[model samples]
Target: MINSRKTDHLEICAQKDVESGNPGFDCIELDARSNPGADFKAVDTSTKFLGKKFRFPLMFEAVSGGTRKAGEFNKSLASIAQEYGLGFGVGSQRAMIEDKSVADTFKVRDVAPDIFLVANIGAVQLNYGYGVEQCREAVESIEADALALHFNPLQEVFQPEGDTNFYDLTKKVNEVCRKLKVPVIAKGVGNGLNLADVEKLDVDAIDVGGVGGTSWAIIESGRSGNGCRLFDDFGVPTVECLLELGELGKPLIASGGVRSGVDAAKSIALGASLAGVALPLVKNYFSGGAKAVEKWLSQFMFEFKTSMFLTGSFKVEDLRGKVLL
Candidate 1:
């Protein structure tokens, strides 16, 4: 059954802490200052998402698929996204499209052939209507350039085999973004996507996935034992869902409970063009594997270039509305 719920969500997100005791990194704090005169060797982490190009705006959130230890934990997280240029997501390929021998658990883009892959699914599998060529054959089985779609109705209304028929889900995600070919991100599994649901989604970008972090309704109500204490303090917090979808303009990521690099430069000064971590890189990709997941992602890209040279900012679009106070 979907590879036994993807090995029961990686054995309840690895032996149950069920993560969500408000991990929204204390709702934004990065008035970072040490030497604001800039030039930590001219900080430039590089960017440019959906249309490709990236050196770091960070994204490796989706965690695991149907089995074979999630295809060897996505080939050691696609060799740490090919030695840390970053970008790689693979978890919910709906049990490798309902069993294709778990499709190599989720072929990590045939081993990181130029990163920036992303193709997880489940907006109730597009309201269980699955068309648009089955979401374009799950984005050509993972030559994905974009296709996240997660949204978890509070972990499917407190799971017990949850699916609660969310009818017409935003016009079936704007008809899978008008017949998908690429681009469709509409995440939120930690329950954070507001500003009236991002002004009623058309879809292109938006991850939010907020609420501190890992509270898939306290990890599916602690794997169905269901002692719901308000799913251990509910959602919408990652810097107030990135200041309510960074006042609408679009392109947003800032996933839930981000771990560091100054919580990814305070999620790019609260207007995130990117930044989506997953449970401390799945506990450093299951303990020191791909060179300990590239030494914990090069220590969050050297604390995101020392918080962009102490916030005098040097790139990544000069960190948008640059304001770490």
Candidate 2:
């Protein structure tokens, strides 16, 4: 199921634009040439995440642990992330947990030993027997700096083998938060983050996986034989989610439909601590290889720096409050 589903996701992505509603990058207007005196070469593109500094405030986002191809992709991507000083997130380790033989597939520590690595897992899967112990094992297995708990109800409802009984999830989240040594990040997969939903969670951060980026509902429709077609477009756009959840004050990760460095810069300008992107890279990488992925990512950094320079925002951290119109 994991292998097939992973492939299905990629196929669907290649066929069409699977992004949810407008992620809201368009709504944000970057402040123009206000500081004509600010030197472009002096622009600083560095920022910190999970207590570590990264050259760019960009995340490869989670999409891992399924097939041999997925594993190979992860290994190469992890190396590039480490070489460039960016954060890397492994896909769900559920497959490894269910079968130890597949563990090596998600093992990226060897390639990106020092990068800020994040372990991935479905939060709702906790209600079915997952616990703090499993979460610990996941982090330990990946040598991860933090653990990201993904909330993907929309996608699951469309999956034939979906488990929608999310009962006791909040209880489990708080329990795990108390016991885990690392920070717990709350992420909504293509559904956007809700402060109310996480009010009870002792999360260290939140990824506004709002809509306007990969509409999982649509992706599942292709796999589930159109059963989920009715709700193809759902959830709050990424931009709206960010603006709404930014008030909560938790470290925000803008994912969903973040396409370019300009889009990433837009997210940071509107309170995102870091921006996350996955779909575009997955497509490009599949068509090319590691170099393709690197070239594309390097472009993000270039555009991000260009955006910073144009806005006269010299620092990545200060962009949140100073650059957005």
Candidate 3:
């Protein structure tokens, strides 16, 4: 059942019109300078997260897994991360947890041994009998560098078999963060994370999978007979989330409608540690292949570097709180 859902999600996301909302990137523009006072050819986009250095502040966010075809996508995506020195995350591992035989579908250490790989699972699962043990297994089984406990109450509400029991989920997440050996990330599955909700999570980082990217509600609605269409545009925009969560003192990962390197640069300037791309990369992979994925990323980085240069920011760190409207 879980495996089937994974396939359904990948198919709908790749083939259907799943994206909605404005990530607010369109409103935020970089202060461009004709002569940046630095060499454009020497712009540096490298940064460190989870003690690993990324060639650029770009992460191939959690997109697929839990099936043979999904496994191929994971391998291809991870290889791209390895080649580019970026971060990679697999989709929810609930399928592997339910049936261990499918665990290989989420493992990519053989091909992406050096990149910062993140293992993912639904935080709501904690309310459904998943705890530290299961969380650890998800990480160790895949040799992941960190763990992203994704909160998807909105998507679950739309899912036909959704586990909407979010009662005291924060307490369980804190327990896992304390007990889990690897760094724990509190992630939102679209619909972004608010300040109040973020204060409750003792996570090491945050992936504001805000709206403006793939609408999980829309995806579930497609599977559940279009009942969730009303909430297709739900959640905070990615830019708003960054503005609200910038002072929390935790590394921020900006996702949801991050289409290009310029969007990525805006995110970094607003205090995001990394800019994540999911649906577009998924589409690129399906429509083309690994080479296509690589091509898209290459262009994204080019645009990001161009933004950095035009903004007079040499390194990724220089962009923090520097760019203006």
Candidate 4:
């Protein structure tokens, strides 16, 4: 299941018609040329998350893990994160918990010992009998700086092996947040999050994995052979997700369909602390390797800086309030 699951996700992402919904980056308009005296060269894109600083507010997000190939991907992705001084997340460690032999696959500390690594788990797994101990081992296994609790009910219900038991999940999240010794990020997988949902979560951060990026529903449906194509346009776009989730006051990760540095800029402009990209990074890395990823990151940073400078945002914070044109 581990290998097949990883391969399935990669293949679906590589070939399937999976991306859906409006990521919402295009709707925003950045104001130009008002601050003629603003220093373009001094515009800073650095951001702080979970106490560590990154060169840019872009994270690789969670992609794949739990197999040898996944481990190799993690190693390469971690190298990219380390090179760019950005944050990174390893895919879920549930496989490792179920079978200890696969634990090494998620352990990337040897390669990214200093990067702000995040350990991942499916929150629904708690209902399947996983508890705080498994969460602890997941973090320890990777020396992770934070833990991400993924909430993918949309994908869950569609999955054949879905665990629909969400009973007492909030209590479980609170337990993990209290005992896990690191920050916990409440995340949605390509489905938008709102203020009410954010309020219900007892997490320190919220990753509004909105629609318009990679649609897990499409992937799951394609795998099931029946498809949920009609619902492919479901969920809120990343921009709206960030705008809505950003209001709840938890540190924000603007994910889902952030495709470029400008998209990341738009997210920060809407009050997100950082932005994450997963599918595009996966596809790009798969087709191009490390150099491609690095080139893309470099271009993203350039576009982001260009956005800020054009909008008179001299620092990352400057882009927060007055970015819209």
Best by lDDT: 3
Task: Please give, for residues 154-207, the per-residue lDDT of candidate 3 as tens digits.
Answer: 988888789999998889999999999999998877799989998888999999
Question: Between the candidate structures 1 and 2, which one is better when assessed by TM-score?
Answer: 2
lDDT of 4 by residue, 89-178 (tens): 989888888888888877777877778999999999988888899998999888999999998888878878778887778888888888
Task: State which candidate, 1 or 4, has the greater lDDT.
Answer: 4
lDDT scores in order: 0.77, 0.84, 0.90, 0.84
Clash totals, every prediction: 4, 4, 0, 1
Steric clash count of candidate 4: 1
lDDT-wise, the better of 3 and 4 is 3
C-alpha RMSD between model 2 and the true structure: 1.5
Ordered from best to worst lDDT, the candidate numbers read: 3, 4, 2, 1
Every model's TM-score? 0.34, 0.96, 0.98, 0.96
For all the candidates, what are their Cα RMSDs to the real structure? 17.9, 1.5, 0.9, 1.4
User: Which 10 successive residues of model 1 have the least lDDT summed?
Assistant: 21-30
